[model samples]
Target: MGIVSTYLRAFNTNKLDPYPVEILKRVDKPTTVVLESEIPRLDERESGFNRAHRGDFGPHLTRERQRFVGKHPLSAALGNMQFTLAHVVDGIVAQEKAPLPNDPALMARHIKETAYFLRADIVAVSELPSYAVYSHSMATGEPVELNHKYAISIIVDQDWKTAEATVGNDWISNSMSFVAYSTSGFIACILADYIRRLGYPARAHHARNYQVVIPPILLKAGIGEMCRIGDIVLNPFLGPRFKAAVVTTDLPLAVDKPIDFGLQDFCSKCGKCARYCPTGSISFGEKVTRNGYEKWPNDMEKCTRGRVGNTKGSGCGVCVAVCSWNKPYTPFHRLVQWSMRNIPVARRFAVWGDDLLGYGQPKLKNKWWLDLEEVDGKLIVPTQAGQRGNHRRKQA
Candidate 1:
């Protein structure tokens, strides 16, 4: 076998029964996905930021994203990390180059191994889809010009312990998102720089910055399946509790395929995220065709408002907190996960059991951060602390 094939064989050949087994159901190609062959490239300018910029959701989101995130110490720390890394996203290519094989498969394997070594939870590669690139930059309002041959997607899980304790949209909400966002962004930046040093054109697309829409590339790259929680992809291991960053490059590399861990069926039966969504944003009804792809229609306006206008916290993650797939990999959770993937009937039980066991409720005693909010211009003790505040559901 080639070096790449050997590496992938070992990677996909885990003895953990039905763990990688569940995830590595490789086929000649991705399951026939419903896609708009000529979908319009998304415009980041017209996104929720547009509404935020228009003073629709709230003023804080428009003036600076930090207004919401800087309310808490932990969230502020994570947000600051992004600020530090935001400047060097694109950098100089080194004149001296490292000797490496020209084989795409070998290169792909090496890149994946590199990302894993850098603490990326999951990584996938795919040919860059035309529709995946954003139509324009929200930063400069110019058409984003990117024609990379491959996309390297990196995913990072938000710390589950924090989510386990949080009431979803608590003081820790933006921190959870930023923690994953910053981590994945860090990985992507280094990976892209590495590729450029090898005499290739590479650009890191991250949380605070991007020239592409990630979910589409992620869907095509086999990292996860499309989720009902809007356009985000869901990894079987991390579910919706992760954020992603991508390195788009012209470096030749082998690619992965879209995954199918029975998320569509599970999401259909268990509309729990929609049921428990605080802003009535996620659709509890059937999926529909929008601009070509069949997906659950999300009210980004309501979702954005819920996140920006949260009285008790900086942002929302109720959907992530309550996803049936968002469980830790304990033996019990593993068995349940296997059953849900293999035994179709178990999906209903899994969904119902998540609530019966009171899995979505917060653990207030686990709260450890300060109860501060940035009001007007200064930080002060908020009247409603995230730990003591009310959520859509009570604790178990």
Candidate 2:
């Protein structure tokens, strides 16, 4: 067998090491989930944030969208940096192709290595699915006609220390998202530009500028499985605690298959995210087929309201903070994670143990950020803050 085939087989059989960083290298095909029907193309304008911006959710959410970034000073700063790089996602390509070996496997390996070198938490490549491309851009009301052959998916972890500290909907919420967004965008931009220098058509898709849907690309790239948090893909290691950026290109490269890692079974039984969601947006029922995929669907309007119209905090990440898979990578935790993946019988205990150990509760001792919000162009600590912890208690 070829090296890639051998590695994939080893991964499928669980022969490789189970380290967090090495998880991507071991994945082959999805163990449980399967795409039974063709997914329909979607417009970017139909997304939750865009719907909120257009006042579909309500006037409150539309107004909140305007101040969503600037409401938190740290988020404003980080968002500024991210927005600045959006302009460079696509640029001129070299006229002459570089003299390089025509090996897809080698190219894929090099690209993944470069992404890791750029500080990406995880990286994977997959064939770009046509349905994954948005029919129209949200920023500009023009058609998105990206025909890139491959997608290089880059994931960046939002600092676990910060995630562990707050109540997951406090002042630091948007900052955590922006940090990952900006870092992943930066890496994707550079990677796309590098590919263009080799005379290939390439484009970077990130938070500030995206022509493609992330969850499908993430799934096709073997990044993670669609968890119970609606459309969010959850890595066995990072859960839903990270953000993604994609580099689409005509550059030849090997593609990764979707992975399972027992996420569907685990997410079905563990409803901690649904239990802790401040607005109760996540569904606690069985997975339903939505737009061709079988998954739990969240209330988009409610989710948007909790995020954009949030008064007690900047933006919500309560689900990310409370997921059973979102654990620190200590040795013991890693062993438990492995069991959660391979041992189906252990999943129930794992779910129960997560709540028993208070894993999803806010770690006030780890709190590092100051609770500040920008209002009317002035920084102030609002008196309405700190109620999310109380809300969590009430829910418990």
Candidate 3:
């Protein structure tokens, strides 16, 4: 057993390397998709949840946002942690700049390595587009003026194990999101502070505090491509199964170009996300031009209602749960992922095979979490239909 343990540890271990997976190392420049655009700067207040908070979506949705945290115990706990961290996202930059290398390439590599050392799953750098910055803050309704030259995007994977165990809009839904949200936010905060210590202006952008829009940054940083799941960017590896945090910095670094993994074609062929979306929010039709980019546009009001005002669960992730791209990285799954990227015919067949193989259904035997909800100030087993959000009845 000792010898086997040693062999396994030595198989492909890199003490200095961050990624244990091989696919990440193969990702490089020269993006395949050509995005034509005239994107305008957006206000942070226009976001779905923010709209819910401001009663723009509806008064009922505003009430939903007020009680959003306490709907699920685990989600509430995680939300509190991230909200606390938001208070420390910005700080004073040091007066003197630290001595550093002249090469942007070297600096880029070093910064990425630092993120990896801090447990970031994946990191990419991009020249921050001015349009990505929000025109005003949602929290304070004040003008946002971020002029950072480079943006460091970091991704944290939401555990696939938990995703496999239950329905998309169950007690575990928001917990899946907050797990990635808090972890990525923690890493961004520390990375930003480290840059400030080096005499660079930096600010962390996470769930609780974001002054910048993420989709454009994700595209420009080679992180992923915009998918049919509205503005959500899907990575070749992580799919729509992860959350991201960003650090906007004046620190010099080499930026990566956008990547194309044939997601646009694949998403077009596979409508599994649309088929399984609880509120029928995802579009099952062709791409259309909205916000200067030609992509599938979803109903934001319905989607927000499905999430923030969900009576069936804490929040909905049916789209993420059923996406063809969301799969475990087993040997067979990896082979399928490669074919989906390279072979056009395979993309069509993979979609059919996913449904045939029952890839989207819940595996109840794997359930590990309690079906508990927090009401007022106590945690209790949700026995009634109303308490459990009447999700089973809704699905019927």
Candidate 4:
């Protein structure tokens, strides 16, 4: 078998059991929300600086603002997908009343095939180590039991056309994330159904219903290495232009080896993503041992708050939009990726050469859908933040 097939086989080696129906009895009860007075409106004055920057920067800024708001829509859409899957899985689990099929290998194959059918770019499965499960549940305000034994990691590709149209803090940049998240959610839902049909206990872990840390699971699945930006950088494919989803189950499965694509060395020297991060959430230095692993720890809270306070959008994707690895499926880029994968020493030079060639620079005029408007009367322009001047100082 080829390397890809070998990896796939390794991922598929697990057993499953009948779904656990009684577990549903332990599910936390839903809560009710009380409506307050009239909803408070966001202050325009508070957002004046962001708006002025947007206006001065032109259509790109407006697009960036729109992209942030659009992220919420995609997130909401993913939530709905999870909801539907959970309902289906709940019925299956209740009927089975025991651990479903315990074949890890079959479950892995089913996950990969179903995820691809649902539009995911790639899917891989790995065993969920005890340490991988959260020690505490933030939602329930209690410690979580490490019951899930496996995780099916899924990756969804971003729209390269829309990404190419980005101009920094524009709507197009944010839209890329939305597309990935929305697609990942759909893929997760489908995989959940497949597992249930195969007589296994499985749960879709999308944007809101995750019980596992997806990046680590993807790492174990050999999909990608964790970069300095604190995101998975898929080999020869998505780089950072993708979102991840996970499906946790009691199914037995084989685990994939962690990939070592010299990303650690590449990220150490290539700070383009960090430089492009508007909120400085990405680390600029070396990876450190944190919580028992080597990683470039990110300031997620700062990044999240920055997006919330921006007034123009709910979140940001400048780091993803500017990564050197986040390229489209062009022959030249593919050749470069192949070279970097085979020859590790050449990666540093390649990174330098790519910057010299302005490969990571966002194009403002490549807006294919700049003139397109939705039925809601909102014009879909590219974001201007993508076009911000390169802030990296030339290496001496």
> Which number leads on TM-score?
2
Backbone N/Cα/C clashes per model = 0, 0, 0, 42
Q: What local lDDT does model 4 show for residue 229?
A: 80
What does each candidate score in C-alpha RMSD? 4.8, 4.5, 5.0, 11.6
lDDT tens digits, residue span 1-396, model 4:
233432343335352211111111111111111121221222222232345334543555545444444344443344455455444322264345345456666645655666666767777777776555654543453665547678888777777765666654553444556567656766776676666655667777665444565665676666677787863444446777778878777667765555555566677778887777777777777776555556777875556555544544334567767787878765566566656655677888888887788765667678653322232545443233323555555245
Q: What lDDT tens digits, residue by residue, belong to model 1 across residues 234-284?
A: 877778988999999988899887776788888888877887788888887
Stronger candidate by TM-score (3 vs 4): 3
Q: Candidate 3: where is the Cα deviation over 4 Å?
A: 1-37, 384-396
Query: In model 3, what are the clashing residue pairs, if there are any?
Result: none
Model 2, residue 155: what's the lDDT? Answer: 93
lDDT ranking, high to low: 2, 3, 1, 4
lDDT of 4: 0.58
Model 3, position 362: C-alpha lDDT score = 79
Please, what are the lDDT tens digits per residue for candidate 2 over residues 1-396? 232443354346433223333443345655435463567889999988889989898787888899999898889999999989989999999999999789998888888888888999889899998999999999889998999899999999998888887788888899999999999999999999999999998999999999999988898888888888888988887889999999999999988777767888888778888778888788878888777787887998888888898898999998888888888776577678777877898999999999899888888898888889888878998776534532332233
TM-score of each: 0.89, 0.91, 0.90, 0.71
Q: Candidate 1 vs candidate 2: which has greater TM-score?
A: 2
What TM-score, to 2 decimals, does candidate 1 have? 0.89
lDDT of each: 0.79, 0.84, 0.81, 0.58
- Candidate 1: minimum summed lDDT over ten consecutive residues — where? 387-396
Residue runs of model 4 more than 4 Å from their true location after superposition: 1-91, 94-107, 138-142, 231-234, 311-314, 368-387, 392-396
